[model samples]
Target: MLDLRLAPMAGVSNLPFRLVARECGAGLLTSEEVDARALVQGNAGTRAMLRHLPAERPLAMQLLGSEPEVLAEAARILEAEGADGVDLNMGCPVPKIVAKGHGAALMRDPLGAARALRAMRKAVGVPLTIKIRGGWDERTLNAVAIARLAEDEGVSAITVHPRTRSQQYTGRAPWEVIASVVDAVAIPVIGNGDVGSHADAAAMRTATGCAAVMIGRAALGRPWIFATDAPEREARAAIVRRHCDLIQGHLPERIALVQLKKHLAWYSTGLPGAALARPRLFQARNASEVKAVFWGLW
Candidate 1:
């Protein structure tokens, strides 16, 4: 069994975010879902996403693509670039992505995904894994079948975010499907979605028999979620400051400060007039403005 993992948010899991998640008690972290084609063609933005700090050990670079050749090459590139592992994106169900037959579209084509997994297994020296949903839709639920295929192809692990593609982040993730996946694969299966507290994480393990838990939306502004006893306003200030410093250390001061605006909004929820604070934080263009949004408001 592994530790708590941080999922690769589409636009958020950069070096700074992963560093912040680590400080908040995440065991393993994945970079944002990267486009394999972008890496192969030398996209600077995609390359920049590969940056990491010495303290952040065992970080996996998550890749999103449907082509076996490109995905294999990208996995090779990640191994050469010092990544600890490579995880394929077979679960994303965004319309724009699915239209291209890239994301959860793979759920509809298990044979192709299996073939891609095999190719990537042969291409990379480091550990290879994949993240998948229940299936393209409720009608085609086949997570157990896909899990076996990835395992047969030598994937190190499989992550099951149990919402079907059609559900798309709506409703609760079906932990039962995770149990099915764990039963089907010898490798570790990390559970994902809707875990907001230690109890939720613990329940996920108890209910699904998964080895690890991947925190997504619940981890956004609540990184210290596992550490906080009560997770009230009393804990918000300290977490915000620590995250701000982490961001500052990893990125430009201004970017870090502004980025905290979104997180602050989430942390400040349930407080008196958090609505007022959100607009102010977005309107906050500097550090002093951020301080006011947090300190003055409280």
Candidate 2:
């Protein structure tokens, strides 16, 4: 089977969405990035990111941090709470994240990242993986170096988003970089970035020889992209309904409202009259209003 999975997306890949994506055929789903220090400190908000429904099992929890001891403790906590795997976030290009020496900032300091990965690996029995960018910037395109180092540190798998921090999400993702990581590592390499459909996933696998493909942005309004076949309009509507139901049933009221608005907007993408309907979607004061507006447009 062609292995396709959902990439951990901050504010998007919570348990409800993970369940929805998995039901749609995502092979393995990852949680949004949780702050290691906050989780270790027992921060309630961070703890909430760790919540998972039984159906979302075989899920990996992704952590964002730079401290070795803190990351180690966080990994232990996640493992104790039943995470199937722990992934280090090494590719996030957000200014705040990189400024803190977390995420893609680690790409600039291989030795430090190695220490953090080593600590986390020793702290948990579960598989340790990492998601990394091509490099800190164009001149520093060192994904292969990071992949080799991660493999040596006992990281079980690597997911490469082949765009430098400087490039961010702007241009084409260099598939050749993913191919380089695969050639450099004996472990499984998962390719991410710029994949919006099954055809793109197939092309990535063919071009890079990657063991799996992870969908990030492409799956935003279309988790059905994970399904082996394109769902008909009715089936697609059913999926949106189920996703909304899960969001309401599983999330806190305040969060549920925001998620309802965000996802409904995404679901409406490309539909007739959707552009005009978006303002009303966000203007909605309650879930009922939100759904009514969205379904009215639907």
Which segments of model 2 are wrong by more than 4 Å? none
Off by over 4 Å in 1: 228-236, 252-258
TM-score of candidate 1 to 2 decimals = 0.92
**What is the overall TM-score of model 2 with all chains considered together?**
0.99
Model 2 per-residue lDDT tens digits across residues 1-298: 7799999999999988899999999998899999999999999989988889888889999999999999999999999999999999999999999999999999999999999999999999999999999999989999999999999999999999999999999999999999999999999999999999999999999999999999999999899999999999999999999999999998999999999999999999998999998999999999999999999988
* Clashing residue pairs in candidate 1 (N, C-alpha, C atoms within 3 angstroms): none
lDDT of each: 0.83, 0.95
The positional error of residue 233 in candidate 1, measured at the CA in angstroms, is 6.3
Candidates' RMSD to native: 2.2, 0.6
Task: Give the top-scoring candidate (lDDT).
Answer: 2
